[model samples]
Target: MAKIAFILLCHKDPEGIIRQAERLTAVGDCMSIHFDASAPKSEYDRIRKALDGNPNVTFARRRVRCGWGEWSLVQATLHAVEAAVSAFPGATHFYMLSGDCMAIKSAEYAHDFLDSADIDYIESFDFFGSDWIKTGIKEERLIYRHLFNERSNKRLFYGAMELQKRLGWRRKIPADLQVMIGSQWWCLRRRTIEWVLDFTRKRKDVMRFFRTTWIPDETFFQTIVRHVVPDAEIRSRTLTFLMFSDYGMPVTFYNDHYDLLLAQDFLFARKVSPEARELKRRLGVLYASEGTEFRISNEGQRLYRFVTDRGREGRRYAPRFWEAEASLGRERELLIVICKKWHVARRLAGIVRQELDLPVIEYLFDEGKTELPDLGGIQSTIEKRTRHRRALMRMLFDYHKTDRLLVCMDPRNFELLQDFCADRATTRLLEIQCRFCDDYLTGHAKRIGLAGEQAGPEAMARLLPTIRNDLRHESDRIADAGFAHLNRMRETAGPDENAVPLAAFLSIPEDKARAIAAMENLFSD
Candidate 1:
């Protein structure tokens, strides 16, 4: 039997939460509990009490106030995922479930069922082409722009999106994203979880776009996994049965669902009301086969293999070829500017996107020093990153035509880029050997609420010279701009960044009588 960890993210239904947590832990399963910060402190304390002294349980230290249709929901989910991966790094799989979801299958059966299957189960669909929901639902959730700052501002988001649509303000999804909609809950492998976390950490454009969309929880995971995970065969079936309303809210399970839940072989069911004690007890009796053992024969193996042949192909195929082929036809000449970290990537991507009107991609080659959750290691971490990138190497390699680079030589990455981009051209690289200016201008502008805001053309014209490279072939185009202002500074105000003159240069730091002559050997004579 495979070891699986369940990530339970919930705000309400504390009774159901504690009940499920107790039941799952009673068997051999562990849990990562993230009680919504907005929930009553007593509710959280009660869950903690039930889980107290359980070595397998890991509580999310960073409690988040999760909004229903906001990115905060995704954030709370990620927090639970972070805790699970931290606690059980070698877990076979992670099943994301709500507080109401209870397993009907026995632990042995669930493990055997999962062990028999070879693919991930994600109930997904092309939102625009779905027949279950009306066309208007697609336009409302996917087409219109909905901005939300918190949970209570749902009415404001709705009204604003309506007004924007009336004003003909088109909310366009980026060309790179092939939007797919599906259930927010699904089971994924450990590798898939790590990949999703790592990919989201790098690709913030996807995150930023979804942060403003409605019910992003339903679309974000599907979109990322379908597009990025090469050749992943997503079974269009959810393990849990969820009945939804016309407005997309799940209906709570009642006693009537007993027969329906048993009719199907679904492993789990959701939205079980706290008062449905009879239904819960009946479910427990019906599936009271927890300690039972099961067996499979050669006939069963043959049938399973035949049914899952398509997924078997994925384990052998290098499916990044599909992503590469799709990327080759993209019209957007995206400039993927590499930074040493995500902060610098964001700062540089903002400047480059505005200055040249380029479709910008800011990517960090290495991660360090941030509040985001990440495992620690310098060399080993980078080595793992290199391997992960190599998995998507075809798509990454194909972007070389329009990829721009900004590299730091502070302590040098020591041929990491060469190892990563060994087959791609490196001539257009812009290496900067100076102090970073994030704290200088960007930080100040951010405090004034101009974070990632574009500078106007007139301001861009002035800033280009100060920022553009002296190593580029196009460097001459802006050469006379910044230096002229610098020369005017000499005549009007000061000498340099250090602000020391040649007369007193020796007084600052020199071994000889004059600093200019003392550094003569250091000059390009």
Candidate 2:
């Protein structure tokens, strides 16, 4: 049977650490904990006293004052490793954890998993070749010496690197070692852990070189393990479930993340909030009990997807509803129908869709749910208007594989419509000017739940001229008509090529048609 010895590194939260240590050491697993020397003595004393009697738990003899991007963190880990290896000589594997980490599974399960394989589990990749580092001094992190704590004194830290660069000073890595980088959390077989300890003790030059290396703890063990272990003997992945925010800070799990935590296949998780008493209680039960099986859940996948997408795409940029800009669609035949009342615009859009065999989107820029052609009403809050615009573009250009789209929108959203439609190559702007549509405006205001202050003729009269003048500056396609004209067109139901004014208003003008056709060859595949 495999005996797993956990090495915990922490500086704060003594109660949380004690709870983690007790749960990890419950089923005969051993632990070696290192309290950061910089932490208050009271915290250290509390944890030490609480776990002093446990045979499986021990404290590192030497506590190091750790710092970001410094050697003290790696030194702390080494001290804890020395303590664990010295105390548990018969252990099969050593797992590295933080004080905030807790076991989500029974120790028996962890032992069974490790006993099945002797291979090391860690995240290791060639430092120079991988794109793991998002933003920072990449190659310089290894070649240039980092003397200052990056978190405490960033200006000096970066200034020193600049100074070194001007002098062209660089350090050559040891000839036998290849620099590798990975997550700080890892689980290694006892033989691998012992080998790393022995190698570090003898390689004083290597240790000296890494003492000033940026964030050495992440690279030191990873580089050493990859140097010795054959490719087949290492897993190159951490067993602890972890996630980071866009700011490169570890995400802390709270009680609300119970479903997310329970669904993880990893035996343990890190950076749990100390205030998550419910989460601790539930996970503690799972850690001490048996028969609970770990299964991958869709909830976990969705949470990861949300986080990864947010990191990549970032939050959708949303302008204020009234001040929103019109985002241009893909290069296609786009006809924008704008009017004071959307009901008239909707009727006109239906006629255009029937005539041109195009998809018509009703109230495309409305503040509420957008009425897509076949998708029905998609709930789009004000903040998701950018996303809706992108979806509209994709539907017109990609999904349906169509080249023509007709959109109905109220002139109240015409803040940037002129600029959007100014490009006449693939776009045609049409406006139907209504003398008045108070009933439509009243219903719209009520439906949007703003009838109390926004529905009456006073608000409409004050707002109408500004919207009309806003559209008149850059567009000349305005057709002055009223509800009577719209009612006539709806009664006629179909396009009348010979009808006097209605035909003129409904038909796409000959010059604009020729212009649009002329631009088609430019966009042809």
Candidate 3:
């Protein structure tokens, strides 16, 4: 007989919370609700009144003024859990949920799944080594004293952190505990939860340290549970489906995402749109029904793709490139081969392919010409290409799972150059400047809709300075030849170094490995 006591930490949407409490209790489970102190009295009253008659529903006696990344959130959860333990002694498991969380699978499935294993489902990773914390102070969050609420007063919070840094003030963590972090939402066994409560009550110093630590809710139980539970009894996954945008905001489910929700194997999902009445109603009916077979989905990966691909709605028009970068995860090592002439690029690609045995993808950013022939046509317009540029590049990189990739792109593509320069950490630029700029000048003149669409010395001269400045940013990984006339070839062999002339470097080589060796030497500090 596996029974779950759901601890729902809620802040808003009284009607929605009441509906969730009713559905959970109706399915023979108990619920412990904690309304944030910031929530209006009227909203709290409405929820309490709706569930007053339900024996399975209980509310936390003490409300805490909870803010994002504040310790009060953890306090509120503890209070709610205390109330729940007293109210539902038969609860075999304690599951943490949020106000907007709704069951995606049936209650029968959750009970059967829990009954199969007394294992705890929580993502607890070593704080220092894990790359889980994408942004902000990772180790510093635990080391420094963070009293101010980041959500309420961001300036003051950061200012205090800076002050502590300048003053060389730091706090030592408890000697017995190892710092661990994960999603705040988790499912723990009753005995495990009891042990955690007892541990927290006895460990005043640990509690005091965490009192001002940043986002203690995400770390508190995660760190505590690891000390008691063996690794075999823990699963590094959450039953609830919670996806955050790369910017750390939760991706909310809407009415149209009903199918998306159904496809996910997660028992419950959170941050559902409050106005999604039809979605909630359909999922509620599914939650109460009996089901034995559970359809599996790689939803974590799928939702990430969803956020990157489908999340582009009116946001493509935004000026900031980071908006798009956030959707397309982290940067990977990328090699960009820049040259004015396509013929030069083709020759270089062939040499690298045959000689160095390295992969060479040609004209990846060319209009109507890409490695992905199927996704090539959209490059006709600058807007279309700019919007889909990072996504296209990300797909290209993903398709070829190699450490280094050689991609040929037109040097005149300022937008592409800007993007490459912005992510200097991973971008390796190799530019082969052609002596005869007439062809490139004419082509660029035509593209910009220049008068008479003809190449002139003046037009070439005007464009040379801009191109040179864009290519040679300080401390960027770059190698180049030619462009002596523009007066900015930093490491190019001077006219005196006759052995490796610009024209000779471009010529077809009999000794291919030696030619590749010479190219590598160009990038020398």
Candidate 4:
């Protein structure tokens, strides 16, 4: 059997360490854990106690304080590697493990792949060459100055630039050169591990590079390995246990995408939720029996089943209506109205104000809303709700009353509104698929008496006469479009003459005569 030395860097969550150890025991010949000294006393004791009797496990002597952009993590890792090398002298490979990482594949399979590949699996990118990095320097310098004192300030400022310059100093490799960066969580041959430790010790410049660098944990191994063995067999990508979140917080795999994970070539994944008892049970069964046909009953409902067939690709088709609805509701205030004419918007605004009893603001992009203006003649469509729209929506939602209704010219214009209203259980939404002219006609007619006397004559006339001709034109267009849509629906609808067209019920303009004819057409199709 190929001996594997598993080295884990743990801080909090002692149970997580135990779980990781248990998983590693299935594949690794030995395990060593290094606890951060700055961690709470209770956590340190718990971690020590959990791995107490494990013959393959040993606790490191030194404790280190780790921080973001700090050198401590790299120091701790290096310490653990040296300890592992001394204790497990004959181990074939050294594998880095994290407290939060969990093995997703069988230990034997993982070991065989590592052994066969004989590679490092760290990913290294030229960070200094990135455009974002260039732009960030000035801002990062300002932050460093603001956060650090005079002595520390100069050190960090010059150190950062020096690091950037050094990173920029990479030479084009010969055509035959096959340099590669490995994954941080990786299995390395003992020889490769020894080389890395030795390289770090002998290279004083490398130590200085890490001592002055931000995010040394990520940079140190990446820099040293690249410097030592340019053609090292470092795997481009591998499946390993990693927490999805920055903090490596535990979470339940409640997403539909969980099924797709089983097909991935990765051998590990992380931070499983303790509450996922059903998932645990199913996984346990599959792990023990190597049988995929494991089902779990939740509240008498057969919630999910795992099947072992190699070809069984998990396919689940269920629309997340609630999720979609909630997302829509959250986006309520981020809507913009675009129309060809200003008079049409005024008239529509009047109707919205009267019917919905809400504030309506006319917006112009150039003029910008003094109170709340519509997007300045930029065609308002669903696509407008990008980052700019999010900010605009937040402003509008914050300023406007919750019960207020927003009017947009078309369904596309109302996309943001639809999304915003989707989650609001308390807010009622009425989507009108009418053109600018039709909107004017509705608004004008609603306010004007049959005898042509206006209830609010001055306000009504301002919108009416300007919108009248356009309203007549739009009404005809809407009628034609509505009929065309209805005709298509008639061809596919079920055999029920009494079934009314959804658009017709929503007061969408359709040819009344064609609609009547289509009533019989419903069943005939």
Query: Which residue runs of candidate 4 sit more than 4 Å off their true CA positions?
Result: 26-28, 49-52, 130-184, 241-260, 274-491, 494-525
- For model 3, the superposed segments whose C-alpha errors exceed 4 Å read 303-307, 310-525
lDDT top scorer = 3
Most TM-score-accurate candidate = 2
Estimate, for each residue in 89-158, the C-alpha lDDT of model 4 and write its tens digit: 8788777777655455455555566767666766555444433232233223311212222244668656
* Ranking of predictions according to lDDT: 3, 2, 1, 4
| Each prediction's number of clashing residue pairs | 0, 1, 0, 24
Q: 1-525 in candidate 1: lDDT tens per residue?
A: 677789899887776777777677666678898999999999999888877788778888799988777778888888898999999766787888988887666777787878886667776677677663543346667666677643578588767877988998876787887788788878877777888899889988777788878778888888877776664556766777666553556767787555445434467888787788998877665454657432211121222233344234324223244322333222321122222223443553354445444444333334432221232332134344334433333343344444432222211232333333333332223321223343444433333332224333333333333333312222232232232111100212222422243223212242221322222221111
Where's the lowest-lDDT run of ten residues in candidate 2?
A: 481-490
Query: 1-525 in candidate 3: lDDT tens per residue?
Result: 789999999998898898889988898999999999898999999998899899999999999988888899999999999999999999999999998898888889888889988799988988888998888788779888998888778899889999999999988999998989999989999989899899888999989998989999889999999988888999878888878776778988888776556556578898788889999998898888975454353344443553374345334344364534543334465666676566766765676677655667787556454445345555455466566766656655566665456677765454465565565335555566544344554454445433123333553454445434443431132223222211112234443332233223333343443445355334321
TM-score of each: 0.52, 0.65, 0.62, 0.49
Q: Candidate 4: worst 10 consecutive residues by lDDT?
A: 294-303
Positional deviation of 389 in candidate 4, in angstroms? 14
lDDT of 2 by residue, 108-152 (tens): 687788878869998998999998899877888889999998889
